[model samples]
Target: MAARYLVSPRGGRRAYPDITSALRAAEARGRAALIEIAPGHYEEALTVRGEIRLAAAEGPGSVLVSRPRGAVLDAFGAVSVHGLTLAGRDAAVDIVGCHTGTLTLDRTEIRAHDGVAVHGRPHTSVTLRDSVVLYGRTVFTGSAGLIERCRFTDAANNAIAAIEGARVTVRGSRIEGSRIHGLRVCDAQAEIVGCEVTGTGQAAVVADTRGELAVTECAISATHAEGILFIEQSRGSVDRTTVTDALHGIVTKSGAGPVVRGSVFADCRDTGINVQDAGLGTFENCRVTHARNVAVFSTKGGAPEVRDCLVSGGNVGIAVTEGGRGRFARIGVEDLAGTALRVYDEASAAFEDVRVERCPAGLEARGNGGTTAEVTGAVFRDISLGAVAIDGQSRVTLRNVTAERGVMGFAVSGEAMLQVTDSEVAGVSGGGFAALGSGRLVARNITVTGSEGLGAFGTGSAYVDITDGTFTDCAVAASFDEKAAGRLVDCVVNGTSGVAVRHNGLVDLVSLRTSLPVVRHKEKPAAPPQIVQVLNNPVFNGPVFNGPVHDVQLAWNNGHVVQQQTEGDGTHP
Candidate 1:
């Protein structure tokens, strides 16, 4: 059986004068004891060392236990506090486990003016339910605990901190107005579910230095810095969470690899998700919108795998720079003012099934050295500038790509190398494909239609090779100029208004079929037989071989016509 004791500030028959006297009497009884305190203010510190329960005679806010300094209640045994207000200048409640001690607080209010509200030491356990902690922090060091339906407001530091191997689970909590991080887990493990954390000074949640955290179904907003930060080799997962109005939504650095799934990040100032400094992360089924800078950025040797993600309304959609590498699949980028995807500065990326629409530029690869991008099954539509641009010693390969309704289709410049296979460019206002400034282009099985300018153009010492290509409805079908050199094998030009094939530089045409004539410019003389071979070409109008046509064998109505004009005349032969 349990013994019950009553305490009152005013003396009465069979009632103790103070709570200390009643506690002492209950301790001497040596059984489970309950000490009921009357509705009065007790200005004394208390320590519980036995199995005891402290309750208020009235309801909550009726009994006030206040201490000027130090902890108001120090519990070392199995202790329970119900419906009482504990206030202290240093700490409101301190639990130090002697032999796996436990403290339970139900429907209580704790106030700490300058220190922590609840502090649990090693090997202790705490269960706090329906409680409100104000003006302080709750810290667990090497302890395990559960906090349910609690409100921690106006915390001086982090509202909840678990460090030094502490394991904590917080459910149905509202942590608001923290001066520092809302929840911090360092070298510990924490699970946060169904919580709302708002107005944090720093990151809403942080896991650092081997700490593990799992956040699910939470709404974290209005953070000054990153909404969730994982650094120093920490690992975690965030599922089905929404983070909004932060400097950055999620940041992973220093070898941290966190798996984020089914999340939405919106209205961020900087990048929505940043993976840097050798960090690794997997983001799947995520949506990022209205970011000021890039939606997703991977840099400094970080390699992130992004799949089935949508990025909209950012300055740049995704950037892999500064030795970073990424693999992206099934990505959609739309409604941006700048380039949709950019890879540069010794970075490399592989993209599959990527679609970019309503952007200034689609995909850009520029670097000083050692940058590479491989794209397969990509589509670029409704673009203002070039759909794909490759520059500065970078190497890019595109297969099964389609560009429609763009200014230009593909532009390769500045010593770059581009290999395009099985591609189509349609409805472009400018040139379909261009290789300029000592660049190299190798295209196979390409089709160009409805281009207002030249279909295929090479200039400025560029080298172009096209095999089995078709150009239709272009002003000029193919033009090679300014010391450029290339070979066109088995190519056809149809419905061209201007000259079908105009050669101002070195070119070899083999088995070419054109509707209009082939014109060699008078500024540059034709090369020798091997360099300028017009072999087996069927022309509607006879070619105007202006200057020194060597090895020129034009077939007209299945008959060979070999003519040489060295005087640069406008005569057709």
Candidate 2:
């Protein structure tokens, strides 16, 4: 008659365009009818129950359901809620017990309360697209569901909670600003892919008591707690994801350890990635930067395998502390302000084939009592302080290494046993070997060269041995630290200032020389140490061999010592 469809409400009417009347006329017993809702505000809750197509004529903005309390569509089979705004100020749209029917909610607004709770029965399929479910808890406890391209913000509710089910996928969704976890899965087979979760109290993604949660290729950041927290028997692996700006990057606790691989974790207040003792895990090929504590911490009796990682500019790169141990292979630690490698406080760990570069004090073994550490084939360069600092009064053994550019090749300050052999300490700032405190250092075949300080400084070293070694231009002043006792035998300082001194402790003296005069040995050259290396040497000794020694008056005996090595067979001409 007058260009009209039909709208079914609870009551019936005639002669006028009454939705209640249309619904009462179009009912086909157990079957449902299609009623197109008109645009504008419906002040009361439209209760559509069981098998009906309630289509909104206008868009979400034009069709508003201002219901105070009630499920908008409490239906059974083939119920579709499309393009409608269900504004429950303090209530909710409880999608209770929906089974078999594929509910498509497109461009729909489910605001406040708890948005779109799919509960009760299993095998309930829900495909929500292009929707905004805000200020409510978007929970899916049913089996086999998907929420794609939807935005969920539950300020006063638990964000996106999926529990006690299987085969759930939440993809391409933006979830933020929640009270609890932004996206949490408990006892569910949940996979969050390409989703951006941020600004939450807990983690961006939390897997607690969940069954095999796989978070792949997602960006998670800016949380009050940790970025991604896996705890309580949750076995979830985060692969190739970037998590930053959180309290902790990833916290795997409660006897649960996740395989975290190829991820970037940055700007965390605590450890970049922490695998607690309740969990045993593995970290491979991950880069962590700028952390307050350690970049990686394996704590609490948990064993972790860390390999092929680059850890730089932190206190400690990979810390295996508090009963945590690991196998570190081909890992590198560079530019550390403190000790690069630390085996701390009753911790037992091993390093095989590791590279430490430009550390202040290369390797330290202190506070490690009853703790064992073994380093094999380790190489260090540009050690700003000491190549190796032995402390904590423990026994540490290193086999076949090279330490260069530091105060000493080896500096000991603890009571421990060191077996260092077939090593080289070259171009050091001080002695080639310095023993400060109480320790037992047994080194052999150690080549020492270019030492700007003493060849060795011993303070309280008990048993020290240096055999079959070459000391060239080294040990200018032996017996350096008078407070220690040690011995160096069969070692030669062949270059310059070669002499062993004895001041306080037993500093056995080894004497050598760098005093050879040149100009007198040249035949036709009557000048003196001719200054070929420094050709213009008129002011060398206020007595510049100016007494007509020519090249032959090399011995001035001017009450001072001068060195000249011009390589013309000790000639001045």
Q: For residues 1-573, what per-residue lDDT tens digits would candidate 2 score against the true structure?
A: 112335433323522144444445544354566667767666554444445665676556656666566654444566667777766654334633355555556777767664554332366666667878777766666566687888877655566777876567888888888878887778887888888888888777888884567787888888888888888878878888888788888887776667878887877777787777566567788777766677777767656677777777767666766666666777777876667776666666677677888878777766656655677777778888887777756667777777878776776667766767787778887777666667677777777778887665566545565556666676463453434665666665566445534344354434322342111112343244453232435767424433554443243434454665464566652
- Model 1 accuracy (lDDT, Cα): 0.87
Clash pairs (backbone) in predicted model 1? none
lDDT of 1 by residue, 347-416 (tens): 9999999999999999999997699999999999999998899999999999999999888998899999
User: Model 2 scores what on Cα lDDT?
Assistant: 0.67
Backbone clash numbers for all candidates listed? 0, 14
Error of 1 at 564 (Å): 24
For model 2, the stretches where C-alpha displacement exceeds 4 angstroms are 1-36, 43-55, 89-102, 114-121, 336-339, 421-423, 431-434, 444-449, 454-457, 465-472, 476-494, 500-573
Number of clashes found in candidate 2: 14
